[model samples]
Target chain A: MQVFKVYQQETLKYFHSIAILLFVTVGVSAQTKTDTTETKKKPTSFVPTGVRVGTDLIAIGMTRYVDSYKGWEVNADVDFSRYYLAVDVGSWSRDYDNGAEIYSNNGNYFRIGGDVNFLLKDPDRNMFFLGLRYGRSKFSESLQVNKIDSMWNNNPVNERYSNSNSNGSWFELTTGIRVKIWKVIWMGYTARLKFGLTTNEDGNLIPHDIPGYGRTDKNVAWGFNYQIFVRIPVRRQQ
Target chain B: MEFGLKAVNLSLQPRVSTMKKATWFIFLLIIIASCLNDPDCFRINSNVIGISFRVMGTGKSDTLRMYGVTTQNTDSTFYRNTAATGIGIPLDFTTTESEYLFQTTRGDYSIALKYDVNVQFVSEDCGSKYVLENLETTGHTFDSIRLVSRTPGTTAGGNIEIFRCPRTDTMAVAFRQLTLSGTTKSSQALVVETNGITPDFTGETLYGGEKVSIVYLPVNLDVDKHAMVIDFDQVEGGLRKLDLNYTLTETQRYRPCGVQIFASEMIINAVESQYAFDSVGFVLNETNSSIRSVLDPFDPMINIYRCPDLDIAGIYFRNRQDRADSTVSLKSVTVNFQTTNYAPTEPTTFIRVPLNKSATNTTVTIEYQTGKIETLVLSYTATPITRFRVACSDQNTLFTNLAVVAQGTTLVGSQVPNASLQSIPTRNIEIFP
Candidate 1:
């Protein structure tokens, strides 16, 4: 049911991706069938061969350098033929002080989806892919403000508002390239156009920033991640 | 046919030799990074809802004098004694609903509004602000109300238009003084001091102790005859009586505005008294007089004429360089053997002197703060003329061809630019001393 729910939310966003995915899948299947008929051997089985585990270098660098940001993301993918199932997990926290108010938020998030590799014939097994991701974040936020309303009799108000448990869901249209550098080490960059963000925090203190998503103010957000990965061979690729 | 994963071992990869592609990718990353920006701390929305007052029948903008405007559950008065055709009222951002009460001279009204308040984070320097949206008028006590816009912002026009029925029972009366400039006669507005004016039958004081040239008087809806007792500042015959007779026709012109009472074939009558008025007549729409609309509710319909005072003339001191009226402390002023003393604390630039009507000349003496006395002789010709016709022909004197002779006033002398004297005060003689 959760998977169905995620698919229902992502159907319109993944319309073009789904069409390309079907075309690539059918073409790859036809090629495999031709290879089997010519060799007269056992047919190709669309089973996982290897898995790539990676960490986002940009998130790590921001956590170390940016005072307002503290977060890290781990990305992993497993391949079946030319299609790869991708998963990402991360945690983020922010402390923002715009002089008049102090706002802070922290949470964990995870994104799970699939990627279709276009570079199927690359000798080095490099990848140039377009993918779709369903991202969800569980967050909590608080704000401290000293507000003085001059229109309402010049009364000074000192208040602290918080949303203890808030969660949000979003969609991302992602495109990236992954290239093998040396040995099992790989390098890649993913550019994401994140949009359609919906949050469950209806309280007075709205969530200023989400865990995976940077801020809730913008309708559409952009994200870029440069990652270094290690290829772990599950089965020998033949 | 069956498809399976490749069994080939994908090992170490060869590096691309093109440095241009790598440089282009790095440059693209730099451009995308430059595009990311922090939100600015500026507010583009307003918390106040704009309201325009319109008449029900005419759909024209109308003004109403507001005594005060206050909100429910709050004691703060945001507006007081303001006359406007439109106004901007603030909504409470803390609550989802607010009720505003407007106390006006015409009537009292209340409007309750409901909206959603969304709080958004601006920046670290600006903090969070509440954005009010989905504005709806839940309830109101006006004759008509319409929401022109759902969201309120800093914009022109109004978010709402409030309409009210036209006043059909009020009539404006103006007091006028007649003047003649060589056979071409004109009239100027005359403001009078009144003790009180009351409806004869109801004994309700419509006006009290005020000087006004025009007054809006409320008439009876049931009766065709209306009488009012106007007590003036006159000594002997100050209590003047005036009667109005009109035919009221009830017609359903606009369904939303309901039936309107139109007064027509109006006739005005006054008691014969020199101290009250010289004559009285209808000013506008005399044949088919009716209530136009609330927009022009104060249009004068009747003109009560008073004879001009020819015995009085104004004398003002003038600045030598700028030719402007200059104020001076005075000791006393004697005109035509009548001496009036003024306190040293009271400074004046102008004084009214009673000229001799029988004789063509009058003697005036003025003592300044320095105890220097100056004498002047004023001359004018008073001719009688038929001013206006009410029940009978009225006659009034016109003072013209004015001349002034000054003695012992040495500063810059005096000049009489306005040779013709008028009831309304004017600089007939400008004395530089």
Candidate 2:
């Protein structure tokens, strides 16, 4: 009971900070409304009149540091009331040596989805969302198996495997938070749980790693992305 | 108002966001720790048969030098230099036979092994493997054979124990008995050289068949052969023996020991006895394999057995009369074996005998439907059986002058009924000498 209470208290503290931020946003909106009334009395609208575009910071960091990871992604969203239409487009390629085998894959993928903002009336148009995405990747992969015949006196052997233009499609159930720390710029993380991809464990074509959705060796795979965005706000909502 | 409701919902938002971040963090950890792989190997093919020997009797302690030569051995001739510990004879990866000729100071001992060599394709990368299954030794130079393991995997372990031949009479020459079928009862049968019937060595008279010393011929690639000259009393009967030899060659062409000896000429070399040649009573006077008679081969049982890799055991019974040199007629006899349930497809003359038999009591019931016979030591393992049963009913009886004389006085006979297609009936006849 005591631990529960402590946890509840800690949770309540974070909520209080969000409440304080909400009050600041609402207070500014109210002040603007009052000023407009004193001059041209009208309330702000909720409809989004401009687009927000973002680049995945994780992909950028990976590409810069990891020799195998060469990938880039851009995300765009257009909001309408509490719902947003989002599209994630990315291209990735990997070339790595996994001890006994050398694996390489390269392709581009697109994930289009709609996210429903749970906070119906946030002042800064921030979003904490539950989203559903349809993701499809068209990639080709090749792996070469290298082995030594110890019984026959350690003879070295090499076998090459490659598939061109192979593709896969999956569904992602995602949850994300988009928070604005400043004007015209926002940063947040989206965590996705992907499903419905074929899980074949036979042959060299056993999907070891997928480009966009990560490793395909599991029943359900997960992906996470942190993005930095620039928003061009247009007309204010009523 | 709606504004009041929004304010109330705002209090719960921070905790929700905090929890979401924690969940995301945990999921991130899981995502980072995923993707495991199975171990890869360079090679995965297994194939070998391990054979070692344990010497028996007084010479069990003596490390008399030994080595072996297999059918797979390019030169299946004598191995005088290579010593045998437990000779690891590489079976023909393709055949069921892995017979090795182990030549010792005493003589050459032949060990016949049979096993089911099962091969399976592992993968395209690693090729295939030969799995040795049911390793049972039917031919050994000992009292009995025992299998250490039934399935010794793709890599054969040192599980098949070959009890080596006992060093009994090193000074005495080993003799193989051969019979002349169509000769008349005469007083003067000459023991002669291979080319002619001149009395090269005077022979002693014996009860039944003639005996001669075993000859290890020098290896010759181009039709090298051995022979002995036999001069029967009746010239016409000698001619009849020649025809029977020809018939046997044509009929039993696919002999198990792969013996394609031209039985046109025969030889009988002198047997080296430790005692005096005893100016009398020695059938094995002159030994020769060249002037081949129907019974030129000493061990008739040799023709029925195959190498271990073949999953089939065979047995054919030939009863000789007591102390007689000739085989009994196979006219009214039948042979059946009681053993593990055998596949009908196993190529065999005896039915219901498994390729791999346990060290249990296996019975070989030979029914002499027409008459009784004497006791014979069947050097057989479960001591060796097939698909087509070599069974005998009263009507479908096979006729052969096959004689086997037990070196004892206990007369035995097996009377198998026509409907006796199942287990052979056991007989208990005690005869005290």
Candidate 3:
């Protein structure tokens, strides 16, 4: 009973994540499998035609130039008619010192959802689409605070606090475009409005930032990613 | 060849146009992203809760004098020896529960509160802030407390109002004298000196060795009559008993105040004393149920009056060698050109003579039984004291520092003892002749 009570919150979080994934998969697959009896009369174009694999260039550039930031993200999508299934995986680590305190955090995150291409009939298969994603992160953070209390005889306070094995989740409404420059090489941007953020109660040490969701203080945060991709054809276009 | 080249250019035209548009979009996105900065530190946050006091029956604001209010974990005090109707206190931000100990004049009480703390690290420039919510009173030791607001603010009204019942058993009696102002009559407060006062119901002596014009006497809740004995000074039979009668009505006026006992229809039922009083009347007929001011609780329900005090000093002739009373014969005695019938037909050691209330000195002409007359001068300081208001100003004078400035021939010496003269007569000087 004691062990179950201790892990109850973690178990509930995992259950929610699994429920969202199942809902997305079942909903999309059910939509695609509709009217199969009329497939002989009208050919269905539901089969995946190509896959795009990409890496965020901005994250790489910040990792190289910004002293306090080190992070990278990879994105991939498989096309099914005018709709596509998208997935993202990323890792972030930050170390900051601002005279009064030292804070550091590191985490890994993943996002899975679907996107609908609005520019469906473009000859080059260039895309402008709006999508939704369910993102979850698992991370740990530590902070060391230093202060001098002038009221209490100038007493010096040096206290260290840390939160280990914390989990956070959020949802993102994404809008961007994917443009094809050449036969296989492609470039695009994804602008994300992230909201509905929640996290595990970690006693005292509140997290300054979530790995995939940016700052944890705000209710809604904005993100932009400039990505480069290579398109590999999985089947011949009908 | 010309046809092939033109077709290739046509195919590349849309591709080139799409690339240019994408470049512009990316450039605009980068510019907007670079402008996203952290928020400024401007908001003010506090973790304070307010508490106020009220009287149960009237729901009036009540003042409370607190010795101090402290928490278990900290040495700091919230309000130390501070008197206020409402006060603001801080809740512990580091924990979910807090308990405060209140030390007051009446007794010590405690209140425990439970809440949730939501801390947010806003930005690097703003640092962090905490908001306390779901404030609840888990336990308390006061007579009654009502939670007015769960989400407390920094206002002075406070979130909790503490209630206590008003005092209903005690009543005040004032001493006053009536004087004629031309054709009109007015009463002024008269200070009486007493050894002690004994209430018949409790049989306890109160306010011993003190001078008080107004006195608070308790009403016997079991009966309608309350009597007390006042011990006056320098009287043959010093005890004066006064019996008071009243009617008590028991009714629940307000549910929160509970059943209140009110006394009214007051009557000065009886007076048993050897000495006579000028008048005794009911000034305020009802026992006060509400306190108008915390500082002034005396509302005098009864007014007992005596004739105003006389400006006089008592002197006893004592032999300097033995410190014993000495007798001397006198034909006539005059004080400040006014003759007083104070000297007895026979020789006496003690005499009471009136003083000059407006003068610093008095001339006494003593014609000894030897038929030789001698003029003696007595010097003293008089301080004008007012008891009630400006209308009664200078109605009484306090004489002090009495001395014999001149003793006519045939007197050896004289000494001033107990220089201050009080309403009660005590020996003020001694003479060696």
For every candidate, the chain B TM-score is: 0.62, 0.28, 0.51
lDDT of 1 by residue, A1-238 (tens): 5335434434532443444345434544554454444443545457998899999999999999999889999999998877889999999988988666788888999999988875555556777677899999999888887777666555565767788779899999776778889989999987676788998987766677889877666566667789999999888877
Instruction: List A-chain TM-scores for all predictions.
Output: 0.80, 0.75, 0.80
Residue B72, candidate 1: how far off, in angstroms?
A: 9.4
Q: What is the full ranking by lDDT, best candidate first?
A: 1, 3, 2
lDDT of 2 by residue, A60-133 (tens): 99999999789999998988766789999999998776566677888899999998765545567667677889
How close to the true structure is residue B149 of candidate 3, measured as C-alpha lDDT?
Answer: 76
Cα error, candidate 2, residue A98 (Å): 4.9
Q: Which digits, one per residue and each the tens of the lDDT, describe model 3 over residues B16-108?
A: 454455446545644544344345455323467889887775677878899999986466887999998888987766567889999998799
Ranked by TM-score, top first: 1, 3, 2
Candidate number with the higher lDDT (1 or 2): 1
Put down candidate 3 lDDT per residue, A96-134, tens digits, no spaces.
777666788899999888888754445687776768999
The deviation in Å at residue A204 for candidate 1 is: 1.8
Instruction: For each candidate, report what fraction of the true interface contacts it reproduces.
Output: 0.23, 0.00, 0.12
Residue ranges of candidate 3 with Cα displaced over 4 Å: A1-44, A150-156, B1-37, B43-46, B50-88, B92-122, B128-142, B146-259, B262-433
Docking class of 1: incorrect
Question: What shift in Å separates residue A98 of candidate 1 from its native position after superposition?
Answer: 4.5
Q: Find the number of clashing residue pairs for candidate 1.
A: 12
lDDT of 3: 0.70
